[model samples]
Target: MENDAETEKEKKNKNNKVIVGSIICTLLVIYLGMATYFRTHFYFGTEINCVNVSAKTIKEAAKQMTSQMESYKLSLKEKSGKTEQITSTEINLKLSSNDEFKRLKDKQGSFNWIFGALDSKNSKLKANIIYSNKLLQEKINNLSCLDSKNIIEPKNPSFKYSSTGYVVLNEVNGNKIDKDVLYKNIVNALSTGTTTLNLDSTNCYLKPKYTVKSKKTSEIKNILNKYVSSKIIYTFGDKKEVIDGSKINKWLNVDDNYEVVFDNSILTKYMRKLFSNYETIGKTRNFVTTSGNTISIGGGDYGWDINSSEDIQKLIDDIKNGRTVTREPIYLQTAASHSSDDIGNTYVEIDMVNQHLWFYKKGSLVTQGDVVTGNMSLNTSTPAGVYRLKYKERNATLKGEGYASPVNFWMPFNGGIGIHDASWRSSFGGNIYLTSGSHGCVNAPYYLAQTLYNNIDAGTPVVCYY
Candidate 1:
């Protein structure tokens, strides 16, 4: 009985051992299944193993790598198919980080979580892949310094081109920088020492200057010289006129046979030059008057009927009586004196050389007459010196001569050889006085002498000089 009981106990112990082994085996299987599920679920759903990435992941990794590139310098070997060189001073990148696995992993979770659940082998593999992607993208972005437009790209990507040939990349369309604004900014930057850049192949714009010439300087000099050297002389008669040195026939360089008319071109030029500044005084005309058949007066003198002795007696009596008779004195005017009322007296000056007579009243020239002086001879010539009008007569004649029915102002110039009335003479100009025709009297045209006689009193001053 004891032997049998010991054997039963050993059997029972074996069964117990077998049952425990089976239960342990089932539990191990369950645990293995659960661990496998968790590993597969986490690895496939949440854990990103960059080492075993697809093409999509690689591309995303590349973009993320490019995003991290900073500013850098670059140079182009050719421009527009030419062997010209271009350089970019500073450039920056703005890349998409979606393609880069390293950037994705770095942004996905903390380093502890990224490698914590990963096996050592997988962790190292993923790190190598992510690092490789980062390096590759960086190089690609740097090499892509020229964008699709073939322009040098910059960081921050403004639409402005730098002097160093760098263009801003990724800017909005139509957002180019203004040239003036860019130039101003460059100048400011240089002056303020904010940035340094080489300005090669730049054009400078400038405004062109112009010069002007003056013409009045020379013209004014000539006008002033003419004004300083000119003189003016005016003569009055039936019509007013001016005579100067230039108008003298002997003074002109012309042939002797050329009988120059008063209306010749040279004469006109001379007249214009002489009276360039003369102001008009007054004009007088020749007219005729008759006081019976004994006298006929016209122009500057009175005609005497030298064949009648009765006419001569009447002329002498009239002269002696007219000196005592009083009449209103005629007045003249001038610019300087304004009127002849203050001076109240007229003076006559006859110039034989110029054949002109100047009448002065109130210290100014009131009238100028063209006169025919006496013949230049010892017996019949009129004396030239200061004299006064002595007498006047309406009818006059010389003894044993025909009657001079009207005689005008008679001035005893030189012992009865003065200026008086003459109505019968025709030739008034030129050397008509060479013939000894007058009875020692300056025979003026009858009307002129009459007018002078009517206008002046017996004591009016008359100055005759060459």
Candidate 2:
């Protein structure tokens, strides 16, 4: 009985050993079979170039890639909200077979197939893509964005004058494409097996030379604002002429290079008009004489004469510096006052009709006397006009075409004409000038000539009229 029991136990142990050996043999065979299969086929969950090639043989992966390329189409998104397409057929695009798939499968290795299957195997494969360059360029050229009729050229930023001041204007972006960049992007898309190409994202469009955010654009805007900020007040006596942004903006502009430009000629025109309106020289004026008779006087080298060139340059500099100035323009000539009656009450008055002379200093009567003027018989009557005192001299000789007279006090106002004492003449004034007169001079008494020569200065207005 004991021998039989021991034989049973031995038989049970042998049966268990044989069952475990068969299970090990089966697992080994399956592992070896899968390892050999992975040598030619991609590991599970394998991906190449964004396409899944899991559990596929090299031939199978190549066929799948070729199939995808046949129907490949790239969508180009434009700035104009328009969509354009480039198909594989249009560019004659095809997948050129290479050993890259075999290399990828070898890199995974049969033994590491479990790791690849358990985890996602994602990779990028360099595709040998073949396409006709000429055909691709032709297709790109035929795009609607490249069409002349459909293309809207881009415009650079600019400066516009407004009520406030000069302001910077934004640029206009249009549907113009950069052909060279577009061509390169399309080839890149084909090489990577990409389906869509965004033209805007790829910077495939032509850009404006200057945008509102550009450094040069901002700089020019700052310059323009500074120029318009100038406030210049031109003073003429009690009157004020204001020049501010409204006027300055008219002269401001921007060039093609986004730089500030000013039209100097426009400012020149304004200056000329201002000068014409305000200048008193050579203009008719009203004068009240000592005899209480009002008279009209004209034709004189006196009163305001603007120095336009110097003042214009000064105005430009002031505006550039953004200066606020209240001043008067430079003048080559000026008068006692900037009024209709520019000649104040300080002058010498000679009345040819009355044949008398009077001198006023600061509205006060300085001297008065009877005087003999030009000889009417000789037609050398002292010309009637306005003039200034050239100079004063003592013990001077007055010479003419036929006569030379010596004088004690000589005050010359016009050429060859002056107020001087005539030692040869015993009497003066009245109609003595009708037949005999001391040339075209005011033949005054020694006392009157002495008073005038002592009180008068150069540039003192000498008014001679009938």
Model 2 over residues 1-466: C-alpha lDDT tens digits? 9999999999999999999999899978888888898887888777766678888898999899888888888888888778889898888888676588887777788867667756544234666888898998888878888889998888888788787766777898876888989988988888877788889999998889988888888788789889989999999999888888899988876777667777888988987798777787767788887788899988756677899899888988999999999999988877778877878889999888888999999989999998999999988888777777888999999888887788999888778888898877888888999999757888998898889889988878888888
List candidate 1 segments past 4 Å from native. Answer: 1-345, 363-368, 399-409
After superposing candidate 2 on the true structure, give the runs of residues whose Cα lies further than 4 Å from its correct spot.
1-28, 44-49, 53-67, 95-112, 115-123, 130-142, 146-184, 202-230, 248-272, 280-303, 316-324, 341-466
Q: What tens-digit string does per-residue lDDT give for candidate 1 at 1-466?
A: 9999999999999999999999999987876664444332222223232222322244443443343223222222222332221111122223323333454433433323324345443332222112233443344344322234544322221222222222223422222222354345333332222223222222211211211111332333233222222223322222334222222322222122222112335544543443332322221212111111221111222111122233223322333232222221111222221222111335665655555555555456664545566656635455554454556555555432443433445555344556666666664534555553455465567665665666655555555544
Which is the leading candidate under TM-score?
Answer: 2
Error of 2 at 410 (Å): 12
lDDT of model 1, residue 399: 34
TM-score of 1: 0.24
Model 1 scores a C-alpha lDDT of 0.38
Every candidate's lDDT: 0.38, 0.84
